[model samples]
Target: MAGTIALPLEEFIASLDNASLPKILQVCSGVYFQGSVYEISGSEVCFSTGDLIKVIRIELLSVSCEDVRKNDKFELPINHTGLFKVVPDEMPYSSIEELLSLRPVGLESSLPFTFSSHSKMTFGTLTLGPGRALTVLSIERHKGEEDQVRCHVKGQQEASAEVRIPLSSRGEFYECGSEECFTLQEIMSSPSLRSRRFHFINTTKYEQPLVLSPVYQVHAIMNLRKNVLKFPSNLEVDVVDVTEQCKDADFVNPLSLTEVLSQPDESFPAVVEILECPETRSLFKCSWLPELNKNQHLVFHKKGTTAMVLLSSLKSRKTQQYFLVSQQYGGRLRRRPREFNSVYELYAASTRTPGLKVSVTRNCEEVEEEGLPALSVGDQLEIVSCTRMELLCESSKGNKQSVEALLCQHLSDPNDVDDDDDDDDDGDEEVKEQDEKTEVLLPLYMQGHFVEILSDNKKYRLSDLEKEFSLPLDVKVVSRDTGLELDPLVGAACLRIEASMLEPTIQASFPHRPDYCFEIPTQWLSLSVSFTKHPLPWPQGQPPKCNIERVTEVTDVFFYEFRIRGNTDEAPPPRPPKRDLSSLSVTKKSSKSEKKSSKTSKAKNKQKSVPTDQFSALTLNNKKRPPAPPPPDGLNDEPPPLAPRKLSEAETATRKAQPNTYVKMEQSIKNDLYDMSADVDSDHDYESMDESLVSMVKTAQEHIVFY
Candidate 1:
């Protein structure tokens, strides 16, 4: 402090420039007007005596103009384009050397400047009266001769002459007003001119003389604070340049995560403090996110690339879920059997997994006229292909119709194996026996319960399963990750591999739990931290082997973001063909007409009609019924009228006792046909009407009375 020069804060900052920046200043005295606190830009500023401030940056804000006459001050932009003329100095100079030395610019650049003499002086033949003006044109120098200034003198009647004056010549010289003009920027940029006073050229509005000074916004940091402090340099405090004395001063410098990546290699593998916590609680749903807090320390392990995959849990009515998956998944998954409710679903599954085998879950009664095959619960069927088949029943006009059907082989139960002696049979003979199995045609419109039959019990890795099967494939985890303390997928009954992705991430962890690391996807999460001198948690040259968390729980937002990025290449499956409502209505009408005819025929001859029990076992492959022989007279044939008969009292009582039961049976049959038709109509396309056979048989029985 003995040798250092202390100046007002403004003057010290004004003496410095950008090239000599990053200066450290010690506040020698504090300025307080009524109070010690000052608010600037929403931040409190209180500078105490001996406070050390490290000034990192200085920016020109505006030019402060003070009216010298009235002591009034105002601000003007640094880019002001208005010109100002130099005001003459009232004080007179005693010698020519003093006048030239006091100029704002070099003598060579300040040529042709006017100055008037206060008293007449004679230089040989030249004579000047009081208040006569002379302009200095140039400087003259001869060999071994003293330097002199070339002066221009104007005589009477617009005549002018030049004369040389010695540099050491003594005279009472006064600066005269000149026509030269300068902008505010030009005056502020020159140190010598900055000290001079000026006034606006337009005197009508601004008649007062002004003294211009620069205002600077200083960006400084205090030794006791963690954030940089910014304030204007016009404060009334005084400071001294102590940068040389405080060479070891430390200032807080925080870096963002993006900036951390720019740090050198040797800077990594070091400890760091979180000056500002990241707002990632909502962005990433993970177990470790809550651990990130301000002032918490982390071990910034070396940066590298990591390949990751995204797995999602099956969306259910309970909750939809997502995950940030990695290739390090250690669990095993087994394929889960899928269930089907209709033949359409079966066809859809067979297209993906050819040669699919399924077992019927419910019994289906056969309808021969409609081509529906009988299927018993637990019956096994192997789907071969889709084909067209002709129905046993004919149209009203006696024409046959073909419909789409699934060709399948009804497999026999394994428990009912042939005798052991058949094992020695030739391969050809065995093939022939296998081919003898019954083949059934399932109509596309038929609705029945069925489930996939999974025979293979092999386990598969998640990555391998994704490559081998198409998603959304259903699977159950057979084994849990032994490395993880708590595995989310452990107790899940079933999970669907909704989608997969390959991502690049940064592996990071806290210093307390260095061995347990979580990946920070460089493309997703945003965070910032600064390296500290704190030592590593482990010994020098040896870092503990970390167990990285491969799977991370995420929200549906992550899934939506993945979709928005257009990462998937699979197009949507084509929609099913639209059903023809007109054809369906026509089929309903034809069935109604057929029902009427069957009822009339049954009423005419009940003994000749087959019983309902006999029709239940009929199959689509059965021989078609021969057409009834044409009437004896094809043109006109009438049946004889029935003879009325009287009933006995016992017979009449029996009919009255069973009337409710008979009517209930008829209503049940009608409801069943209506339900079957409703299920078929709900589908996108109806390829066949195989359930009509049961409706025809039930209708014929409605005509028969109990007695």
Candidate 2:
């Protein structure tokens, strides 16, 4: 990912200052309040300097008594002074003149700062000494103005005080260059008359004068000589320093960069340097001069001139532009670049290399050493060491093949092989390996998980169960699942490729994570927000996810009983059954005898196959059988038996057991109910469906039972 290229100062500014351009970056917040300052760590420039992200200021002027003295009109009865925050978006159409004509809003003491936040803010405390406080008094007619309440000020002081704090602490200025130590003498030169100067001073919105460029010297020297006018001297000319904030300033001259570079004045001479493109064939090294000129005013500076032009032919899918720069020390007798006037262009450009270890983009974006250029499906290219032009490779496919070959050259390292990158690979300890531009503690947000479950119908255990129950019960689960795919954890559900038609019930709750305030552990607490934003013309989930099963009744319950007190633990008292299960069964067995029983209640009834009951209940009073052994081969079965059944008389007649016996038979029938009924809207027979991992409640309203 290492590369280099030059960019003209003017073009460089344009590229970096795109208002909507979002860069992967981090910043130390610079705002403060209370005894502490708020330092920002986000990449968003929500507020900077005096830009007023959203701060309000209001000042009250004049009182009713002052107006009474002038117009003999007494509107307010007493004290008067209003100052408070006004909502930024709510500026009234009328002026303060009209506003004052109406009744006052409220007392100043009750007025609070316009904005507030729970998280400690980091910012500078713009200090204003009490001497700067502005207080105006008038005998007026108003409730609070009358001092009838005298609550805003202590000691019932008659004088009211109003304070307006300035945004900055000092009004300082620096020279355009390092000649800050120049005396009045050096500033007053005669030959060139006056030198253009800069003034960074600020004064209360009022126009102030400090001799921005020493006009006195220019006037004096102009009166003294004629050659001074002919000298054409430009002093410490505020040559837009392409190296600092000045580079981004819009006031610089367009030709200034060209003037600073040395170029040949003779026949177009060309000097070349090799530019390596990860994908395409290297392009020819352009000369800086009139050689590439195809027009009058413009010239293609290919060597070390600033890069403002992008050659489309030289571009790859992964890159938007690449500059061809000319050499720095060029002259008329040296290389001359031909003129180019396409909407996009490539030209010679120069810029100093930044000293930081961070990797920089040669002709496109700045990237890290390990960064890889995003490549299209099939692209091939190679870097020509001799020519410096990135040449595209031609596969059997031809042109598109060439495009594909160039794209392949974008790989981060030509010599390296690929292996799945580890998750914890960041050069920094706090940032995770795969988490790009994201802080580690953000999702767990001080350590916690965000949970959401998908269901066709909204049904789930809101909390994890701690106790197991015999009868099916409606429950809520609060289980702690493993970390989800990182994207959904920190973003909205729409980001999940698995997002689908199923409605998802999402709740943000925290799991166990240490809280820190300074070095001390605070509460294990985290804040969460939730709401659903349905996708428009929503796309279906990926990989064909399973449909959510509908749940109606919960037939049983499960729960756990425990209490926490710091590190101490306590066992909760056992709960009771909703209804007694002793009366429902036709056959019965003693509790004592049941202890020795070996027949599984399920298999026992399967074998006995008693006659169907006339009435049904939640817990059968029927004889309890030995517990069913595990399925012989370790398979799982569900939903215990429903009710007893009786044998038919025909079956009894066929039976030759010890004595003749008669048994009742239940009618048997089969039907394609779903197809025949047309609107059955049913899938599995609820009563006979196999038990699921979770249980459901029965629907008989009269069968009073507890979960």
Candidate 3:
């Protein structure tokens, strides 16, 4: 400390070379420009006196040129290719040795450099007149002889001669401007040349002599600050080299997660302080994320890159969620049937899985004009292919239009097994008839509820499914990961495989839970920490076998972002064509025609008898009262008198068997209402009432009379 000197911050920084680093400097004076704090790059820098700064690195940014006469300053890049000539010093030298010592470069490199003398000089039979120039070509030395400079001289009539001058020769020698040139880099590289004045070779623009100085971007760390500070060396502050005195000074060196990856392996298994907390708390749903606070201590177990698969919860009316599952997940997955709300969705699913079979969840009415066949609840449909179909009914303009439709086969229920072996030939003929009648055409514009019918019950591993099936496949987690303290996917009903990615993460944990580690994805989360000297929580040579958290919850935004980055799937199927509602026309029948049709239907019903068996096949039986017959053809066109509606034998027999079944009248009314609602064609038919509803009303009246 006694031999240390306090130099201006700029001078001390310029004198430093990378090989001699890293030097510690004490701020002898505060940085002030016009009595105010100096700022660089929007950071207010006010280093207090006595503050210690460890100068870790210095980078040569550019060369600063200052005009001596005008006091003007500007900067030139270190790679500037312009040439410059050294300006001669106004003061004279006393000896040849003194003149050679002041050369910008080494004496050998400055050979053939010309100079002149103000007075005449006689050197042992050699005479040099005033204002005569001599070029020192080289230096010569002999045994037991003083060093001498070999000079090349030219006089009147272009006559030239060579001579040697002793090193100790004395005269009023002055340095003369030379025709030789040097670049900005060459001048700045030489320690002695940096102090000399130079002028541009092309004097047209920069005629004035300029003094060149090196400007360095100093990279240092203040003891109070956690991050490294970068500032130019031309600050108006003074510093002293205190590295030797404060050799034990401790500085907090904070490094980002990305920077930590570059550290040596020995740096791990050590405690570290969190300097900057992670800013992306919303991206990850983890308990440790909130605990990652500033100044919190965590033990970094190790770092590694892990293969992860991104799973997303099936999107519904609720918010869609995402999860990151490590490839090491031990849980088993079972394929879950996907649900569709429209024919277009079913078509899209068929593209991914051929021979896709689905069951109707809601009944759909037939639209003959639009080529939409009727669909009843519990009906199974096997999507065969896409084709064009012509509607059964023509448009209002009497023209038939072809539309795109899905061709599907209606599979009969398995419960409808036949037991008639004696009539096998008849049953075979009936089966063929049913097959031909089962082909249905569904237009893409129709909306219906359907659910996928999955037949495979085999369980598959998460990784196996990801490899075997293309993503966006739905699955349910049948088993939970035992390693995790809380697995979010354990009870999830359905999850979709969004994508797979290889993530580089840092395995870290809290000091209290050194053996329980959570990964910090270096690419996703931004954090900064300082490795501490604190000993590991565990004993030496006995590191804890950390249990890493493999599953983490992420937001839908992360899923969409990942999709954007890595999505390579083909474009989605083209949208279905819009339906033209204006083209559909419904024909209204006249009163006379409606009456004739009603009579004909009633007569046909009378010809068939209802089965008396109690165990009858279950079917969608929708019974409606027949409309009153219109006036006879020759009778007056007057409204008919209201009369009691006639009932079929099935209804009569049911009533007789349950004469005291009035207690069940309410339940029978409910059943009748449900059956009527299920009739798709009865949506607009208000004239007809279910026969059971009428019977329930009559039975209630009769019970009132008896009571």
- All candidates' lDDT scores? 0.76, 0.21, 0.80
> Candidate 3, overall lDDT?
0.80
Cα distance off (Å), candidate 1, residue 379: 48
Give one digit per residue, the lDDT tens place, for model 2 in 577-668. 12223432322456435644645676556544532331222235746543432232222365433333445889769974442111111011
Model 1 spans with C-alpha error above 4 angstroms: 1-3, 109-111, 140-144, 253-264, 274-531, 544-707
Clashing pairs in 1: none
Q: What TM-score goes with each of the models?
A: 0.46, 0.11, 0.51
Q: Which stretches of candidate 3 lie over 4 Å from their true place?
A: 1-45, 49-220, 228-253, 264-267, 315-320, 365-374, 383-410, 420-422, 425-447, 567-573, 576-707
Q: What is candidate 2's TM-score against the reference?
A: 0.11
Residue 386 lDDT in model 1? 88
Please write out the lDDT profile of model 3 over residues 1-707, one tens digit for every residue. Answer: 33267889888888888888888898877557756466788866668788898888899999999999999999999999899999999999999999999998888977779888889988789898999999999999999999999999998899999989899989899998988788988887888988889999876888899999999998888888876678999888888888888888888877889988888887777788887788877788777889999889999887888889888887677677789889888888899888899888888889878889999999988866566678899998999999987754333355566777889998877655555665587876688569635888888777899998988888998889878876668899898878888888987768987677889888998888788988888988888889888888887888878788989888766777777787678655444444454442222345567889999998666534332111122112424434433332334565433334557899887764433434444555446555655667854443334565456445544444221
Winner by TM-score between candidate 3 and candidate 1? 3
Per-residue lDDT tens digits for candidate 1, residues 611-687, read 43334324334466434323322224544334335568998877643333344555564554455456654543312
TM-score of 1: 0.46
179 in model 1: Cα distance from truth in Å?
3.3
